[model samples]
Target: MSDSNTPDPNTSGAPVPPRPPLPDSGATGHPAPSTPGQAESGTPQPGNGWFAHAPQTAQHPQAAQHPQTAGHHAAGASFSAQPTDTHASRTTDAKVGSGKIVAVLVAAAIVGAVSGLGGAAIGNDMFAANGTSVVSQGSTTVTVNDPDTVNQTTGIAAKTLPSVVTISATSSSGGGTGSGVVLSSDGYVVTNTHVVTLDGASSDVALRVTTSDGKVYDATVVGTDPIYDLAVIKLTDATGLTPITFADSSKLNVGDTTVAVGAPLGLSNTVTTGIVSALNRSIQIASSAVPDSGEQQQDQGQNGESPFQFDFGQGQQGGSSSSGTISIAVIQTDAAINPGNSGGALVDDKGDLIGINVAIATAGGGSSSSSEAGSIGVGFSIPANIVKRVTDEIIADGSATHGLLGAMVGNAADAQDSDIAGALISDVTSGGAAAQAGLKSGDVVTEFDGVPVRDATDLTAQVRALAAGAKASLVYVRDGKTLSADVTLGELTE
Candidate 1:
């Protein structure tokens, strides 16, 4: 129960067991300026499980244990950041993990900091003054003319910040703070599950939410989808709150302008800018970082607050080793996401919510964890499409369902079939969707549901992003011949 800034490793993401390293993508990027680093921010909380096929599910036991290399993985290492609080002491917080050439899909609580970030933006003129001020009276009234023009970044901040809020969690175990996006005017909001649950340390944790306009409200967990590491909370008696606009993440492209709004390192309403560094990235990390395996119902949270939704026990999910390694498809950005940025908004140029900020890639390998978690220009976010889908289901039934491919897969690169880049099928579950579609051993999946399949990680992530029983098409190659099939996905099982 120490301050969340420097997390408590044992409570958050305990060290992961040894496994084979993911293949390096040779990813590279300019390091975030050292002016504000993750060193002092806090430990990890959704994580680099010390830590992607981070929803990394495949029928193969070995594939579930070890994910293949992601061509889109960042250069160097991956780590998780936990949310930090405003507490003066950051001692003994969450754990921030790292992996060579992979982002540790560490749960939230292994957060990073954004100290001096606003100053850096000011220096870069990102938050430039509206216009020069005119001085008329020294003591009485000062004359200031309106700005002739507003920069895109400045306008974006003005438009989006009000919809974002700072979330503080409290319990006997010290409290933490993370960011969230207001989804409805009546106070339904979305954030990372790690932020709400203190990276799974205490389900009984209480939450206090503060909006950009200085409004505070007690909130309760409506429901949580730990498989995707996302959660929904409702502000008590809240009304007239600004709801964020959602963008079609499937339509996004690399290099598009991205603005991240969150409370990074407890810095509320903090805004940072960068480009969509990459897209359709399948990052696989240990599932332990994001536990609960399925949907969780809330009976109560934070002082007599009634739970928002009734748990019917209708939605239960697990496919990736019952909390082993999992793979997730994320949008990569250089927008300076720190530990506390979990559950925050990654918006497009138009202030539309395109993704939810999640994890940052710290510099470390499988051997040891980063000293702390922060931004390194390599940050990850859950796509807006998934956010919308999961949030809708949570709001409707207090739970969500994820699609399953029900196949054992490995990297096509491992098969040395250089002719095509895809997920090489080793085995297909009997009576499973894949098997019903005529998929079998020795088949290479070239595409799924119209999305290209680069490897097992990609396939696993795409499958988990959708719901069970969804009909989708697939393309594969067998014996150097391309094949196609229409398949109905199955429900993921523990």
Candidate 2:
């Protein structure tokens, strides 16, 4: 319900000694981070490797590390066998309803909705009817010719696996595993910013992507929307890639089937299944560390290295920081998301893209360490509709725009004697859209654009999901009377 949103595991909680940097193979796994200013444990960390599961020592690795780990891992024999898993999948049939209010890290739900991309959104033809796309103009994107009907869970998994990828990001700081979805032919991939940037640990990241076909390729970040926790990266000289089919998430209903595909715990080609637990669920969390210049640094990694942070060396970093808090809307599902599943795909029964996996709701709260972060049948994703809008803008313009209500608002529940759940307009910017529409302080917004407005979080998430200059209808309460009005939204500038 708050910022306790547990970002999917950076580590599977399996504590293995850090492996040495393999040539052309990304940064080797490093032992889990110890307490502040302490040596990392090379010995196995008992009973903490994964969330309610055993670590696949052969596949899972301690992802994301601090820079001070320069000398932590010894270079010698391999840490574990580097076997490739092409068609690996196991079912974890768990489900949770959207009404379940569980404590979770809120990173995934922070970004609610956004609708622009304007001229840039023109190429949605790339994702054609029934999840098929025409040949991309400048690159080769292989699609499943008349893919099999996905009536069952296995069918969904099989249809979508090839389009999901296991991303290994390493930096001089450390390295860890996450997930991504193929967006275009020219090797454009959509993933969580935390995955490539290791939860904003470092800006300098080198990425190594392993597709479901067990093919590995190097990639670079095309752009990132940290406020939304979404990022687009492009593969280098990539071809024959199977593009994912897009589903209209706004048309989805509760109880529809969902299948999540990713590399959870660093296990590649992993799949889990669930249903659409809820919609328009808004969340807020601390903002990611973005460069003041608002520009993404190009790949500065050396050949055969990852952009993830693994402190195999002793290089130390001081206290880290981010910008501030951000609000977002998300899709809630129970498809067993894990630490490494960030930026992966959460598809529907037709194997169509619906949402991109991000964070999970855990029961308890403590430190930021994901060593024990596991899904409690409550996970969050960026809805495909929003993902499409933000990614399209990022690919075309290197950033995305969000709608502004031009009003300062708060949760109505905070008002004494208030008996409703909605967003209370505390102040309206003069000459702003809301003010021009006659909205004033003390008005409680109950609905926006036909969607229910539960609170300020919900209102903000809803407004930000649309394009600036977009027009919308809203119902609000004033002086015990209900009123409706049409208002054009404004642009949110950072």
Candidate 3:
């Protein structure tokens, strides 16, 4: 089924109006240029006081010398409490109390005429509310409502969202939808691993991919790296595809415009734009437990668990804050990303893919509650460079492998506690490379392949950058002894 470009109320509706704008608030609520010149209403305008003098009429030259009337209001001005235009020149010659009475009558009559005119214009429809007539196309329309600005993005969206796909995976419990981008003409698609992971085995996992055109394809998982929240699936015999162009994420700077395209809040093919709020931000995927928040409660149904897990055989205890940890840099933006946006591409103004939209920060602890699951102007994405490296590894092999040292490194501040300024061997896998090479717990590997190691995160990144089966020399301090060991790197397995 082709996803319609029509906006969804939850994802693309007009924002709720704040309190009415008062002149004293110092904030202007002026509509954009396309709106009518000014808002019309039936009320007394400024400069109609008893002592206020009317401008000498150049249009009415003959009446310029005549004193203005107390019962009359300026032309085009209407008051709910005044009389009609017939009392145009009621002067102060009348008794003070009588002048006030006539003024009130004139004001009421003018207001009645204005109301009658307004009612006719609206066809006497009491439901002619301001927001009812307008429809929001996306975030741009919600904010500016300018045709040029709204149309500026629609063309690109029309061509792109069709190629975007929604993925669903089923296990013993159930399944959910996540967004994906087409990767090849041969029907290969890429998305987040958690979206298609099987609780037991791949054989038990029922994976389905649906294009925006409503065509559903049965997919076979090609490879996955849950550590990076990425997965690839092959759609049989698919052709005539449009692959997204990848941009250099490193070139992206703060404040650069970006568009987030995905099926957020179950609204397919939704598009939102915002600037790169920050770059190279560090976010921890401590746990998969989503909070009991508004929309999330519906998305997460029951078990307060993540749809996926990051248990890579460190034996660090699954679900621990440290188990699913990927200590790396990420890009942060204000672009709205909701439930299904995970794994979708974060593209630049030119429509080139830059990053993979990922985890959002939740607002609570395990037993806490939340109000919304949609983007709160704080969304994060993995850099494209990292995605390229991991994807390449998975495509070349059936799975991904990262070079590893036998030790886990900590920050510099934490390293001082043990006087080991290198990758610290927290625990060693029995018969693994480090154990076989005489590297032991409490020993810190300070250098790798001639490069100095700073902390655990830096070490993990450097090691992952290297291919498995490579020879690396490590410099470590053991019980105050500086020792060197040569060990062949091993692939990190889950």
**What TM-score does structure 1 among the candidates reach?**
0.65
TM-score of each prediction? 0.65, 0.65, 0.53
Q: Which residue ranges in model 2 land beyond 4 Å of their true spot?
A: 1-151, 290-319, 366-372
Better of 1 and 3 by TM-score: 1
* lDDT (10s digit) by residue, model 2, range 38-64: 123221112111111000101112222
**How are the candidates ranked when ordered by lDDT, highest leading?**
2, 1, 3
Pairwise lDDT winner, candidates 2 and 3: 2
Q: lDDT (CA) for every model shown?
A: 0.55, 0.56, 0.46
lDDT minimum window of 10 residues, candidate 2: 71-80
Worst 10 residues of 1 by lDDT: 69-78
1-494 per-residue lDDT for model 1 (tens digits) = 01112332345446645434544445544333332222233211212111111110111111111112100111000111122222333221212121011011210111122222233332122212334332111111112233223234444565566667777765554345667788887889887665665544457768788887677899999887767777888999998776767777888756556778776545565677877777877666543335443211110001221111000000111122223445667887788765456677787655667788765554432211334324556778788888888888888888788887767777777665467788887777799889999999888898888787888777888888889889999999989999899999988754
How displaced is residue 333 in candidate 1, in Å? Answer: 0.9
Candidate 1: stretches off by over 4 Å: 1-146, 289-323, 366-373, 416-419
Predicted candidate 3: what Cα RMSD to the true structure?
Answer: 25.2
Count of residue pairs whose backbone atoms collide, per candidate: 55, 54, 15
